[model samples]
Target: MPESATAAPPLQVSSETAPLRQVVVHTPGEEMALVAPGNKDELLFDDLLFVEEAREEHATLVRLFEAAIGDAGAEGGAVLQLSDLLREAFDGADARESFVEALVELLPERNFEAYEAELKALGPDALHRFALTGQAPFAVSATPLPNLLFTRDLSAVVGDHPILSLAATAARRPESAIIRTIYHHHPRFAAARERLIELPEDVTFEGGDLLVVNERVVMIGQSERTSLGGVLAVARALLDRTSVEHVLMVNLPKERYCMHLDTVFTFADDDTCVVFPPIIEEPRDHVLHIEAGAERGGDGPREFRMRPLPSVREALEEVTGRSYTFIPCGGADPIRQRREQWTDGANLFAVRPGLVVGYARNRATYEALARAGFHVVSADDFLGFYGDAAAASQDRIAVRLSGNELSRGRGGPRCMTMPLVRMRNSES
Candidate 1:
């Protein structure tokens, strides 16, 4: 198969809540069947998932994104599947070779190097299947990648540049490698190839810990999955390349519940955020502000300045020059807050300003949004009124999705989608 002759999609994501244009997602497949009680802990799954039901739920989420963005094919604003992109990227022999080489390195214990020739020679479709399910014509079997469902943790698009992830765990290394290979070989990402940010292998970084607050500010959490070294690495790259002025380094508790920044804090609108009270609102977590220092004429190495702030809210207000409103994840009850937070109550994905999507199981969280002036509705109701432009043009909306099986993996709407392009803050 030949690559598309048309131009690639615009890859610019400056803010979390801007009108979403293009995004990437993954629907559960055979790979999910590998997740069982025996290996659920090692695979980062809290419980088992009905793969079929999870796929149906994920499909609905994709449909909602398409409806929210309207004509996705127009201006390359469609919701893309990661598997489809991997298959497309495999069109070239170089891409196939690169992927096989990386896979060999990623699974050194499996001795995939021995079958490197056979792996590279396989068809694109077969290779794509094998990449995720670890099933091939050969006798050896690698563990299926179940965590691929959380596309947000793979990589992040910061401003116009795509910052790739060097995942922290061995279970997620292949996810990072696959995304990197796609960006390196896929024609869709050709235009932004030079601007891609590659971090050192020694440092660990994941997309879930990074957030583009606005055009001028980015926030990276130093958490269990993302290291301080990784935060500094990304901060320097953004400050030097883009128009960004500040990189807020948020320090989070190294716990399973607060594994990533998005798990505790996520933007709901231009000036509002859905937060897990314990980590985001309280002073338990520290916030560090990072910025580039004055330039020294010639080709000298760049320097940076750092300062500590009281909290994440204060850091955002100081850097973005705007006040922010925080909505608790589970209304006012402390018990409800902890319960809902565990199920990803605060991990909402904003399609547009004041329009967000999250798990419906978090009833208290939805009630909180309602109290905050948001027009709360079910995913079915939201989709029923899809054709009505006026229905989507409202000031604020909270679309609840059914996540009975999907939430078993400990991720929500934001964890499932990776935005590629978004309108500028002023225009949105």
Candidate 2:
């Protein structure tokens, strides 16, 4: 039997609003040191970050995920670190040897024997540290992966399949390989990673630009980080391999403020979405919809119907049979809207059907959410509520986390997280 017909992966993601089950995260490490006082933009970071402060901020985000446990206490959600995954992959001797060989081949020195000896002498944790943060002069100086913590840039999970992207920027290229390695070699994911969408090297895609709103629909953005070719490739893959029938292609401006789709647009709940007015409302975004077409004669290739779409909301309404509420990122002020959108005000990671996590600094954005019936609570308060049996509950809420250091890297909650599993709901 083909690999696609094999045992299903241990995870599934049908919608953006489902309860998150398992996720992969990478914290900022010494690789961040690659950016100095100058040319930070060359590496894709907006500002310098203190490693300790970023780590502390990440812990608070993790607390929100910890509290998102599903129906069973063990099923809600759990955090998995890339370092830990790499360490687990290294436990298998053959995989370890293969990784070392690949590393040596990629390096200019090609000191295979010396590299092998040093790697073998270190423990698993040291191996991750060595590979990621300590490979300064040789492996990652020029191509430092400071943005690896933005795990959402490399992959997007649709149902039981994970589509791995080829990053548009060279700075983020290595992250895809590292994640592919983990999925290929790690025991936990070995069987689960059966179906995948991997585009050609020339095509570029990123998770922040791809959103699986529901099982039958996916939205791929053409932005500074994701190309039109990338969207076509992923759209074809979804049509061929999964239950996805319609693919929405939204063209975003090639600018820094709207770098990714999630930067300017994200689903707030089942019936609402947070968006920058300039992109989703002003008609600046060029839209298209794609679906499978009739097959040709024998020995001929499959065809697709790609046509212009009036707006993404039209198809979404047809799919869900409901009208959506669009909340502006920075309220009604255009100046504040432009400024807040640059800070990732629209990027919110959903914890459940009506719950999400967002940056605390976007005051106007949170104010909009508040007016939309979203109870905005600090990360500490939410965590405290999780520990209390008598805590009052609301219909929906946004657990805000301190994002001073994190936002400096130019990504928000949804950009930092890569959800591997989201428990299925009745509607899902």
CA RMSD, predictions in order: 1.9, 4.5
Q: After the best TM-score superposition of candidate 1, give how far the Cα of residue 306 lies from its true spot, in angstroms.
A: 0.5
lDDT of the structure predicted as candidate 2: 0.76
Question: How well does candidate 1 score on lDDT at residue 254?
Answer: 89
Residue-wise C-alpha lDDT for candidate 2, range 1-428, written one tens digit per residue: 22322223466788888777677788877787666667577778878998789999998887667666533222322777776677667666665666565555344343555656555556565666656754533343334578888999878888888888677775666566567667777766665667766677678888999888888988888999899889988898898889999888898989888889899889878779998988888883278878999878895656889888667677668656689999999898998898888888899888777787888888899999999999888998878766442122335887788999989999999999988878654533
The positional error of residue 403 in candidate 2, measured at the CA in angstroms, is: 0.7
- CA-lDDT, candidates in order: 0.87, 0.76
Worst 10 residues of 2 by lDDT: 1-10
Residue 61 lDDT in model 1? 89
Candidate 1 least-lDDT 10 residues: 1-10
The candidate that achieves the highest lDDT relative to the unseen native structure = 1
Runs of candidate 1 with Cα error greater than 4 angstroms are 1-6, 72-74, 296-298, 388-392, 424-428
Q: Top model by TM-score, which number?
A: 1
